[model samples]
Target: MAFSQQLPQGVTDLYADDYELKQALTGQLQHVISSYGYQPIQTPTFEYYDLFMNVPGTMNSDQMIKLIDRDGKVLVLRPDATVPIARMVAQSQSEVETYNKFLYVTNIFRMESGESDRSSRSFSQVGVEWFDDAHPLNDIEMIVMAIESLKQSGLKNIQLELGQAGFFQSLLQEAGLTIEQQLVVQQKVDEKNEYELSRLLTQYQVNDQIKNQLIQLPSLFGSPNYVITEAEKIAVNRGMKQSLKRLVELVNQLEQLGYAHYISIDLGLVNHLNYYSGTMFQGYIEGYGKPIIQGGRYDQLTKYFDLETSAIGFGIYLDDLISIVKKQQSFKTNQLETVDVVTEEKDFVKAMEFAQELRGKGVVVNMHYENDSTTGDPVIYLSEKKVEIKGETFTFTTVEDFLTKAGFKNGNN
Candidate 1:
């Protein structure tokens, strides 16, 4: 098979309007996250494969794209930003601080299952990680930012489904399920397969009361007020009770902040990443199949690197997000109009000077010789004796007259 004209599966090139739209989306996200005091940071594009292997539940090894270094060490394209960021924070600080916040815009590489052409193996992500903050306010702040991010992206009809990992982890502990059994239950619950979940619980001969609550887990989703009330009734132990309390507080605060309409509860919401230790949530917009925004508390992630502080953050799948933005026609790209300067060879020097002047005033300028076809808006035809703009011809004089006639007064477009 010839490969000259083909790109590898699951990768793509962004050009023209698509590329500009992506840039616009990225800039909006950066502005929104930065306003929350998150300074930008970056990690290497590749890291030692062991960095992920050492942290169980970080990512499936099969999904990571790997290569061998010259010295025979194995490396992988950065599959996740959170893991590498956590590693960096752990290695840099002698002692964990009370608060640390950072943001990043980078690409992650991973292999997708199923049809390769239908899925992306590489894509950009915009996200932030907050370290050493476990207060419910921290979780609330993350959720609020996630909501604001989608809203700022020009997405309407957004929903943020909130959950707590501890809610179900506690239920599993109370059921006394082994590691293997717990994984199976989590998968079923995440799938919302009540029948399979019930059959599995019955097969394990779980206590009737606990089994019933386990079956109820998948259905424990809806308005926070209703879900919290129902979840309290099924609270089997203190762990389950505490998880509900924390979620209530978060929802209440969000409600107070006027974001109640965007909040929903999903007790069965399970993140693929194992680092999450507490509050977890995902943001979605109408018509998208997957969550555009995902985040949660992972107080245990840094401990693997010997830094015991708490951490929580979220990542927005930028490629998928831009697609949604394009479909909704919600985000309008501020396409800059270019001014083309067409001139004869003899007038080239003067045309160049005029082009530079327009550029200095923040206008986009493209220089063109007389015969060259022009594509930009507001074409300017300059010659020794005449200046023509928009079909209005003026006898060539001082640059100021042309500037004023072009509607660029005092450098303000």
Candidate 2:
């Protein structure tokens, strides 16, 4: 492809050795997932629209990259991987145990053609989903694994912010607001506009106690203990208690993980994903300025695929991870040597043999005979009688002497 056909904007070609960086992050994330017994999984980059649309916060048809199949049915590039993965787990699994854990890394496409403030329209997300597990311990484990994954990825100065979706949802349920009013409150929460939430709650007619509680929800963020202390003071109706208890148990387990220092609770965080029916959380690194990882318990998510189970999990935003690693002072980009072996057809057999020999010893070798010696900053010139490697030239009376000089002891020798 010519440079004229290069990507328009917000997209970059990885000309540098980004593979090493990606491999480091992938290996660490997979290590944590494996230690936690979560299996790796993959799904198609495009799927039937019906799969994701069942869940809210999924982009509309216009926002997705929609295409028509030969049969005239609509197909979409997967905006997110979790939904397709959930569909797969539900339809593919026949186990009676009713518990499943999965981890995946995939690209998510979005319509950001006109957006400013953001550079890329297409981004990558890494996340995990668990099906049919409702225990509070399940939520805590997910958060801990997120912390572990980041730390294992060589990141520090990270914070884990926990939020209970049910907390705010229960409050809204009791607020007696019309669906429209509830939407107003939700919009405020999504925007993190606390002043509007307060003004609206005060003006609206509702139970004063509930109004005050709802108003306070937006400001309810602090250490887990502090947030829980405030949360317990709220009227503990049956619905409220269920959500509160889950939060408490999750915090207790998180404390046990010795990660309580990195943990905070934000009662205001309402994830866009509605299927996250229970505890929802996000991971943040200092310089990333956005959630580097996001996952939560989505109990109702599997039901869309005809499986009924309580589940929760998270996705690691790999692009976000790379961004953070880029900012972090400790993370270093590795430099690797590039070798291009030039040989004529007469020397091709010997070149092949030498290349295989270098490969077996774990050297990164590139065999190309046409490289302009003047252009390569470092060059290697090889011949049967002499070898010039990295500006040093050595002549040998024969190939046997050359091999001996290079310390290549032939197995057949």
Candidate 3:
């Protein structure tokens, strides 16, 4: 019952030097993550179905690639990294008091494709999580870290769209509309459809405060000063006021970081993930219509795992980012020179000694074994107690000499 068929739609191959680009991008991502004091973490590719599905605002379970485990428990390939990071932090409840900064570079599986025509299945992600650091300053740090990482990746023409979950939550409460009406309003805001938002609020018989707040949500995007001015006028829940004040502080701190020109506040931005109890931000790079980096605060995650702690984090879709990086002309690395070590079995020990010497010096050495030796070049050398040097004008002398030349001053000396 085997048949030759296409790749089940939305999957393709990456070949040749393109693979190298992926590695380069990953290296840059790790460098940025490390610079921010975040340590690397590796989590399983598959987990119990409940890990993702239990979180509200996360994607639907149907979007996951799933199968049954030996115990008949449904296991699923992770559709996203945030939930798994949350699960990890939750599992380590004792570390709640200490600040936890973790970063991960991984592959993620998604059931749906974007608006682009290219077929994609599994993609890579680099994300960071901060646990027990619930200060507004931490939120700003996360944003700055994301921006800096994208910049370090050689990406340009980036923009940040910021939003506060508290603002939306407050507007909903102040409207006093039933849950159903609130959902409708939220839907309209999410789509940035102002007319629909107004209609829903009006239909729910909401007062002017609610109607005005609903209308403002669609228009509440601009510089920090501009947003603060307008946020004062929106008469809603107290949390919304506190949220605006915090956002103002965040913007000021970003200014002090010399990245003020890169920041903008967009109240209309919705889709706050379950873990983001406060601020949420997304990063967009040139030529890529989708956000390359995203993260926010989640103060309630530890409670889910039966612990009490607050945490926030973000993940960059590394695969999508590589595509963006490939389009750039500057990220290309120079080709490495290929070296061949030529020596026969009669000189095998000599060749090996020389090769080892070169290796100790940090040079990438390719030995020409006797089985595959050619009559091209014959090079000879001398061996000391521990020092084996081949010929003059050779790439390496004794292993010790090679090590010194390659920047290894002391090797178990």
Candidate 4:
């Protein structure tokens, strides 16, 4: 039994010019990540289920798209990229004194509710992972590289919202709520429902000061100085103060780095990705309601692999970003390199020779065996005693004459 002429829910195909545009954008992403000295890596689309099973702060069990291996092992379509990269780095024998930088342009799969129209089952991600580097400067570089990568996509009017997930985690620790209570408060805060947060705090018996801090967390966003000043006043523990100080220094250095204009601080901009152990950031451009870019530091995650690595990274959601690139700029995706070489049946030899020469010269040559309908592309037609280019026909002569009149002064040479 088959559904007639329909794709699986939330899965659609891409072809022709759309695929080309995606490839071009992917090249740009790879080039930018490479320019920053990050090596490119490709991981399998699926991995063993155990990779994520013990990893706290990652996806829940139900979220994974599960499969059964031949050996009866449970496998999953990769729900995230960073964890796989961590596993790779952990198993490597390469001796590195300081750090490792890797970037991957890959697809991730997660089960989605196509019925509710919340998301798609598949997505393209361009991301980087810097391993074993805890210096705050490394964090800043990750942010700057994210900005530059978006810029490479020809996107403008970009804004990146910065936050400290560690600060929020520290606050939760200071509150000392039970896991059930914490989960309730986290859900309320994650939804940005201050009213609900208020209600939850009211029901829970915590210190009033901690309750007030959590309630006000939603409003704690502004320019750097203002945000830091306000955060410093209420940050309860040493971790909270340290988180604030790090953010302040990050802003100051970014100012000196001359990227202050594109930066904004949002103390309330907590990401739901619980892996983020420190600074977290999200990027947005005009015409898109959701952030197209997101990444953060997750120092605790690598410990599950027992590698003792501390790192930070981010990924540009290249799937949704293509729409933004198209909407923000005027561009051409139909760049053709091959000129169709049409020939009369008898002149096939000549056409083949010309195509061979063109190929030797690193030019793409499309043989037009029988044209149906293709317009606005370069074509070279050969027949009994004539060759044609453009709309004007030319005498049967050397490829040099064709090159000369085609405005290639040194084309023949």
Instruction: Compute each candidate's TM-score over C-alphas.
Output: 0.92, 0.84, 0.78, 0.90
lDDT of each: 0.85, 0.73, 0.72, 0.80
**Candidate 4, residues 1-413: lDDT per residue as tens digits?**
86699876667798866788888888888988999898888889999998888776576787789999889999999999998988888888263344488889998888865442237778899999888569889999999999999877888898988999878889989787887788778767866789989888878877889999998888887678778888988988998998988898899899999989888888777765577889899998876887899998999888878787788999888878788877876334535345567776677787898878766654566777665327544566655435445676666466666555554333222
Q: Which candidate number would show the highest lDDT if scored against the true structure? A: 1
Model 4: which residue pairs collide? none
Residue-level error in angstroms, candidate 1, position 71: 2.1
User: Which stretches in model 1 have alpha-carbon errors above 4 Å?
Assistant: 1-3, 95-99, 115-118, 203-205, 372-376, 384-399, 408-413
Q: Which stretches of candidate 3 lie over 4 Å from their true place?
A: 1-5, 96-99, 113-119, 177-184, 199-209, 332-335, 339-413
Encode model 1's per-residue lDDT on 120-156: one tens digit a residue.
8898999999996587788888888899999999998
Tens-place lDDT digits, model 2, residues 162-280: 88888888878988898668867876886678788878887777778887787777778888878888988994577777888888887887778788889898888887666767787
Model 4 spans with C-alpha error above 4 angstroms: 1-3, 93-99, 114-118, 330-334, 370-373, 384-396, 407-413
Q: Would you list the rank order by lDDT, best first?
A: 1, 4, 2, 3
Write the candidate numbers in order of decreasing TM-score. Answer: 1, 4, 2, 3
Better of 1 and 3 by lDDT: 1
Question: Compared with the true structure, what per-residue lDDT tens digits does model 3 show for residues 1-413?
Answer: 99977766656677867777888878887888898888888889998988777776566665778989989999988778877877886787677556488889888877764643223667778888877547777787888888888888888787887888878887778777776566567767877898878887788888886787788887888787887788788845679889888888888888898998778888877763445678888887756777787777878766667656677788887777777877776475534322356555677777776667655544555675443534333222232222223333434445555455434434322
